[model samples]
Target: MTITPQWKDELRARITLSSVIMRTDKLTKAGREWKGCCPFHDEKTPSFYVNDQKQFYHCFGCGAHGDVISWMTEQRGLSFIDAIKELAAEAGMEVPAPDPVAAKRAEKRAELIDVTTEAQDWFVEQLRGSAGREALAYLNRRGLKPETLREFGFGYSPESKQALPTALPRFEDHMLVEAGMRIRTDDGTTYDRFRGRVMLPIQDARGRVIAFGGRILENRDGVAKYLNSPDTPLFDKGRTLYNLHRASPASRQTGRVVVVEGYMDVVALAQAGIKDAVAPLGTALTEMQLEMLWRMVEVPVLCFDGDAAGQRAAMRAISRALPMLAPMRSLSIVRLPSGMDPDDLINDRGVGAMEKLLAEPKSLLDTLWEFERDAMPLESPEAKAGLKKRLMEHVDTIGDPDIQSLYRRDLLDRFSAFAYPPRQQAKRGPWRGPAAAPKTLSNGARSTLQKSMSGGQRSDLLGAVIAGLVRHPGEISRHSEALIELARHDQSAAPAIESLIELAETLDSRIQTAISAEQGFPAPPVDNRYAFLREGTPPGEAREELAEAVSLLAHKPALEAAMAATIARFDEDPEGSFAEQARLRQQLMTVDERLKAFGRKKAGSDTARDENSVSSDS
Candidate 1:
């Protein structure tokens, strides 16, 4: 369930902040508060303080601060809900479960558990009894070892329609139907839903037999081969994985999870000793399923069958998962050999071959490119145009703007590399140098540029950036929009920004040439902070640094503006605002560090470091 501000407030109110901190850290009474060495960072003396009265903790040494939820997510590395659940348990409070009807369904689901558990035991008994002889043989012929079968709790359902209803006489017919084991016809007739199949229990994260999947042992032309429990109080196939109960823990150690197309594929990988594999239950991966995968590992490997259906399934997952994509969280696809599934490959070439394939799966971008590139022949302009259109269509589905832009660039680059043949570079005419433009600016021009570069919080960066752009007039047009934004937001930098724009297009270079190199210009930054300002720097490096600097100048004002807006929202949405504020601060901090990038580059050299903080000079 979504965490609301009121719920967060209640959660914080229920738990004594100091007690939670004291569970893992040592704290001593310090007036109304408790103090200890910061758990977030190392220190000999206590700098971290916890106030149960205020329901927050703060570390003075490293600027770490947050309440109970933050402590779990930030310090302990638990996910947000995981943190809340743990705290809710400790405080004797019930956390709102992820399911919307969880509170109402909780009791019903618990009872349904017994039905599934009973069904599971009966199925196992039948598997080992006379009724399961054919199913057991099928399992054997499929190369399933006795131990593997037991490990995954493989069982069988008898062909008789009254098999389950009669076997579990204690459970009512309606209970079995509701638990997804019995089908009720409109005419009041009821029968088994999974007749004549081998049964494998579908479990929750805690290993409860919440649902079941069955594979048909008999081959009837009109019959389906595989079946899963319908959506019930205890299970939702779209939100559940076949082997998550076992795979989640294993994936922690492996730092990876392999998602295959079927439960048998998951079992096959497990039998081969690759225990961190799971599968969606007879469907394409859903958004909820992808989120579940992300919680286990940053990037899960998707291994689908080698047939056209398999590739199509992989693409369906990609399309569904694109919008949910976040930084560092996406899928890697393993395309099996033609006509081979994971089980077939492991049996044919060995686990090492499967492992090799897993070890070098195609990246999401690579998979998308290859699939579309091969979808139709790119032999004509229209065909190739469709390829480009499709690539962007996939990219446009991504939610994060930064990730979206990056995907667009990378995919388009790939498209250009693939669809268009490269040509030899045309020879250029010999270059001729013009005499350095007159080292004198007209009085009217000098006054305007000087006034524009006068002052602001970003004055130092803006002034310096404008100077760099003038020196490299050829580069100004490239970053014109951002420079215009900088001028719009920081009025003090407007005149210099306008002149730089003109210098790139309409105005003569001599005007800027004199202003930058001669006297009476915006005074040169004392440190010559940017690469563009440094003598003997590479032209490419200088241009790149100037672009980054201008971007920072354009964005710094907007970033601070957002932070202020977050602060303004604090009273209305403290939890949300605080979380948003932290994230925005992180972004601002990144920009701050980037502002000092030239300094970092100089750290490797035998010179003074670039100490360029966003200057407040006027």
Candidate 2:
């Protein structure tokens, strides 16, 4: 049975090269390629590289080069047919049965490719000829260099309907029409499909011309601004990106791929020295196109036009990508400023400005939340509920359970914070009422109150907890519920604790590193009980001690509140209040014992380590 080239291409596209090679050779990510010691030859320094975007691996040391199938044949010593069978099984593809008609169709597809390639050559010649003067001037006005124009194969199509037929008189008219180079009317009349426009050749993965995209040299009253080849044997607009042939290799170098709105945007960015950019062909991004982008880079940046139409386009792409999202595979979006595009921004600012925007593209979830949050007025409860409903609807489209749950949780957290913000404490003015005579307090209650007050006044346990939180702000989420409980019970320390948690919510990796390096909080007290706050503490040990400290701090307020409540009931039920007070006293003692145990454990560990060091020295 003869395996068609199309089937092999499908199999290769389905299987990631690195995944197959990594089974034998341990590869580490080095930018857009995976590098490791050459499996074919022994080497101390790593030189073997595998590129998923190109679906091939090469070794600088041994000069071994091949794709997944070739790798299997060379490494595993499997026959070519055997390798194909194995890969076919893995990719869930069935080998096509031998058929004469299938063979004939494949041959016809090749003829169509030849027709498009020939048409592309003719168009390029026209651009360089006298007929293309206006198109050439238009390109020059757009700031395209001679090399850029040649590199992208920019061309021009004449306005005459029979120009292609006159140029390629040997080819039948039906073949030109089939290749999307000519259009046939209902009355059996044929005309050039893309006429009197600046042309762009859209190629496949192997750099074979499959279709053409045309932009009018000048905006006319009734003419469409852009025109693309309709669905043909070789080109499906939804399944193909505008510049994948060039951008795929460029993406391997930059470790990123960018999606723009149109071919013009792609050209503008390329001219600005940003070569790893592509665009959908006169339509919103589709699943197949997104997958193609992902095959090049883990997270492709979608830089849309900054206008309202661009925003709507961004949302449409986001909606299409959400359901197909996987763990490390997702998209980032760059929202250009209002009334600006890549060309406009690059002209106004410089390449650096465009780079900065691309570098900080918003995450898929972030763009979703921002779009929905400001989609409409959220002033009323009904509007807020509507926002929440819309968010969930988007979340529900996610196919991955883990990703869906995470997006749901993250969106709800943002919604809660937005809808029900923390209530602010009212400021107090001077005392208004006359002072009343102070009542005598029991010795135990007074002592407990003094201790709580002293705990608040001095930077002891509370300060250490705050410092620990600053040191490891990421742990705030782990202890958020406890922190909220602590805030409700202890008003004096509540503000600082709540503020720290709030900061943690917004803290990303860069901000967290800055806070840690700057010593954002005051140094904790030198008390041995606060040893976790000392420098050089291991994260695990510090987190354990911090957890204990938080527990004690949280417990103190609850114990004090219970004891005060029991004391207040003494006038109504003397015997019962006395019993309750005794029980509360026992609980307080237990808390104190636990706090002391923490100090003892730390001191004992330090002593043991010191003795071990002394023994080692001796």
| Each prediction's whole-model lDDT (CA) | 0.78, 0.78
- Candidate 2 collision pairs: none
Score candidate 2 by lDDT. Answer: 0.78
Query: What would the per-residue lDDT of candidate 2 be over residues 440-461, giving only the tens digit for each residue?
Result: 3344433332343235534356
TM-score of each: 0.65, 0.61
The weakest ten consecutive residues by lDDT in model 1 span 609-618
* Count of residue pairs whose backbone atoms collide, per candidate: 2, 0
Candidate 2 to native Cα RMSD, angstroms: 18.5
User: lDDT score, residue 359, model 1?
Assistant: 94
RMSD of each: 8.1, 18.5
Runs in model 1 deviating more than 4 A are: 1-104, 140-147, 218-220, 252-254, 295-298, 326-329, 348-356, 396-402, 429-618
